[model samples]
Target: MKNWLLHILVNAIAIIIVSFVFSSVEIEGFIGALIAALILSILNAIVRPILVILTLPITVLTLGLFLLVVNAITLAMTDALLGSTFEIAGFGMTIIAALVISLLNLVLNSFIKD
Candidate 1:
């Protein structure tokens, strides 16, 4: 429970930071941001592995560059599901947002020691 709550908090911060960094992405408010983060986490956990496997060939062919596209797609899907709460405008913006969010998640998780 504590870990889950920490995850939510970290995601909320990531969303806020990403939205601030990119004009194309927007997080409406705290609750909306939380919901978007939760949805994104679920999508990343469940769907991302299958996507990675199916796209392995392309991923290897591109020397791992295809991972950016995968991340953008995941962000776009989260935006679509969360409606206006999370709005990722285009592929470029999605990629930028994803990079920022992933970095933020890494930094937050690093401090948790678990």
Candidate 2:
């Protein structure tokens, strides 16, 4: 339970960092970031696995580069679900933000365990 809250907080921080780095990724405020983080985490868990599995052939063909696209799609899905609060402008920016968010979450989570 503690770990889960930490994960959400880390995600919110990652979202803020990504928003600062990328002009296209706009997080409205702290609450918006929280909502976006939760939505993104849920989408990643529920949708990313299915996408990874369904695109296994292409993922293999691309030597795993396609996973980045999968990640971007999840971020985009979060944006779509959240409406104007979390606006991820384009696919390019979405992809960039997703990559940065993933890295931030990984590094932050590593040191932020329960």
The candidate maximizing TM-score is 2
lDDT for each residue of candidate 2 in 1-114, tens digit (9 for 90 to 100): 777777998999999988888888898999999999988888988999999999999999999999999999999999999999999888998999989999998999889646
Q: State the lDDT at 34 in candidate 1.
A: 89
Q: Model 2: which residue pairs collide?
A: none
Worst 10 residues of 2 by lDDT: 105-114
Which ranges of candidate 1 are over 4 A from the true structure?
none
Which residue pairs collide in model 1, if any? none
What would the TM-scores of all predictions be? 0.91, 0.95
